[model samples]
Target: MTIGLMLNALGAGVGATTVDATARDTPSASSFGIGAAIWVLISNLIGLAVGAYVAARLSGTSDNTDGTLHGLAVWGTTFLISAVLLGNLVAGIASTAATSASSVLGGVVRGAGSAASAASNVAGPGGLQSATQGMVDRVQRALSGGGSPASMTSDQRNAEMATLATRWVTDGRMTASDRERLNALVAAEYNIPVQEAQQRVQQAEQQAAEAVRRAEETARQAADTAASGAATAGFAIFGIMLLGALAAVFGARRGTRDVLLVRGTGNVR
Candidate 1:
């Protein structure tokens, strides 16, 4: 196991140097692609096989079955240990990342010199008064109904219609009174007849419904595509693992040294 890990580390070192050779040149995208993956896979396979052979040979078992089993045991034990270490590493990284932002913020707040920087711009002079005044202005405007709907500017007319349309979409259907008001707002804002306003509202509603349907369909297709990719990756991983097991068995079997009995070897054949 130690031998295999050492070999893997050596290979990784070599690969790191090879891939980083462009450091002095113009920066480019990573050269680590399918070829890098293949290299890692092949190197790992060799390590496992070599480790398994060493394990079988060291066990002093001349039987092929025992040798193969010994190799398998080595492979399994190595993988189990690796999985535990990987899990711990992953957990540590995740925990640190999750807390890093909060930790920095907490540190900044605890430090007197950094506390001012940590605070929001809302703490500046007149910030509170300005924010409160803005809120009061919005409230007053809402209460005033922004003046009569018909007397509004073009931008105001468009904004009022958009707000009403949003409410209609949220409510799933506009009430008869709301629809009547919308038709009047549309007629006044667009300077069109009531009939045309009603037709425009119908068209907008249909278009919104169609957009929602298309969005739903797109989400479903994306989900299916992701599921398919996951399945393919799972199968590929399974095949690679199976191949590694086979390699371990082969290496172990081949490592079974030929043992001859003293009495039988008396002929020196």
Candidate 2:
């Protein structure tokens, strides 16, 4: 029993890790498709042999229990243990999947930033070009101060404009020129008249926020599916190994009985 347990634990750990690492998006040093196939064959064979031998010896009864039964027990134990451990070990990584998704989004944002810069340079004077670099500096500062004009979901940017406009109107803090410019920014951002632009911004913002939430949910489902498949495959392999071991044990016992009969002169010359 002890030997069977140890062999199974060791095999499960190595097998599960190999499967998990190869399952990632990163390139693997090993030819995982081919290597996994070959390793699975050899590992199953080795596990079967060791498990059957240990089970036969520890079955510890001479009451003529079937060798196949003992062998099946060995395989069943291995499969159950592997499934439990692999599932538990992988649970933590499931939660971190969102972090990987966020990184992908960040890459997309960087690509968009480069495109925006190039387009700005191409448009030159008519590109809604800032009168001076200092104006660009102020926009950058406002964004850097945690109010990114570009990062806002369409609705968020709309909400931001509404708040700004409300302050301009209600607080009497803006010069007429500032309100006009603010109105123009909102128009350019939403592509509508100042009043209509505000409503469109609100709608777009709501839609963009909903889209992001849906995307995150989709990502979570994909991650869960991948994890579940790996675990199921692992358990399936363990079961196959057990079946093979039982066949080996039965063959061994039959061979032993046949040898004894032949040696007793039942059919020997």
Query: Which candidate leads in TM-score?
Result: 1
Per-residue lDDT of 49 in model 1 = 89
Candidate 1 C-alpha lDDT tens digits along 170-194: 9878788777777887898878999
**Candidate 2 lDDT by residue in tens digits, 122-232:** 868665466556677765544442244445555545555666657654764556654555555577566577887556545654775687689999999999999999999
Most lDDT-accurate candidate: 1
- Clash pairs detected, candidate 2: 154-205, 155-205
Q: Could you give me the TM-score of model 2 versus the true structure?
A: 0.37
Evaluate model 1: give its lDDT. Answer: 0.77
